[model samples]
Target: MINDQLMLLERAFLNSRAFPEKRYYSHVLWAPRTGSVATFPGLSNACSSATNTASGSAAWAEVQRQLSILVAALEGAAATLRPVAEL
Candidate 1:
């Protein structure tokens, strides 16, 4: 359920004109290195390598914590707005 909400939020962000000039599709494969596979380099290189680093879990945990807070805030806002929406 949380994953679904996250995906929906992601789609909303992607569909918005927040970064009107930026190409989100191409950005996924964009990297500084040459002759390297696009997404593979990001995962195998920085992603996997970070797991062994000292702050990897801490950083990820922090992000999860922040996301939960955001989700809760959104839920609260929706609840508050529901009464007004009914009119």
Candidate 2:
């Protein structure tokens, strides 16, 4: 389930770059009006479990890898919008 959501997010991020005119992609990543950030409860659980077991180290590493990708994508998207926001 988490993988599915991540895939969707990745696609959205890519689409946002391909079509800068679309605002929905940005909305999916962030909602300024409500001031709410997207949350993944399953990801939180995986992160917590990561610290509890040495056996899950590989899984933890993968999670961290995916998270880094997501973060970079978000930062890129935000950087693009910064100029507009400033004006």
Candidate 3:
């Protein structure tokens, strides 16, 4: 439900050209040491949150986590859907 929306948004955000590219993917990994996108404070909190635990502070991380699940579902959906152009 809500997870689905988050994933789509995450995917788009990932592919977005204006996410303030930092260089390395590890930079993308949410953690206090590396910091986060200034414009995307939600992403920062999400990464700062304790591992495998939910927090009121890390709303974006929660969304990201949910998005990961949805991404898997998206992959499944993509597999099931036949390509009209190919047909």
Candidate 4:
């Protein structure tokens, strides 16, 4: 199940890259060669450090890793909850 979710996330990322102009999120934008930067309007100081230090591909890979961890955590938490009908 985790693998499936990760695959779907990867597909979405690819689609976003293919059509960047239509992207809804501006916090992170994909750029080649130079590292991708996070353009968080009000949160720039807090978020830019990490992305600015890494190369483009490295930054992207880290994002993917973090997303995978998040998905796994959400799935695991959901699995532990009882259905409302059971109450």
Number of the top-ranking candidate, with TM-score as the measure: 2
Writing each residue's lDDT as its tens digit, candidate 3 over 1-87 gives 445545543443332211223333322223223235553333444455544565554545565764464455446555444333432
- Structural similarity to truth (TM-score) of each candidate: 0.33, 0.40, 0.28, 0.34
lDDT against the true structure, per candidate, is 0.38, 0.46, 0.42, 0.39
Residue pairs in steric clash, candidate 1? none
> Runs in model 1 with CA error above 4 Å?
1-56, 84-87
Candidate 2 backbone collisions, by pair: none
lDDT of 1 by residue, 45-71 (tens): 343434555775753554344344445
Ranking by lDDT: 2, 3, 4, 1
Q: Is candidate 1 or candidate 3 better by lDDT?
A: 3
| Model 3 spans with C-alpha error above 4 angstroms | 1-57, 82-87
- Per-candidate clashes come to 0, 0, 0, 0
- Over 1-87, each residue of candidate 2 has an lDDT whose tens digit, in order, gives 445455555454553332133455343233222112244322343456565668657758745654654576677555544433222
Roughly what TM-score does model 3 have, to 2 decimal places?
A: 0.28
List runs of model 4 lying over 4 Å from the truth: 1-56, 84-87
Q: What is the lDDT of residue 50 in candidate 3?
A: 44
Q: Which model, 2 or 3, shows the larger TM-score?
A: 2
Task: Please give, for residues 2-46, the per-residue lDDT of candidate 4 as tens digits.
Answer: 555554443433323322344653222232312233421212322
Query: By summed lDDT, which 10 consecutive residues of candidate 4 come out lowest?
Result: 26-35
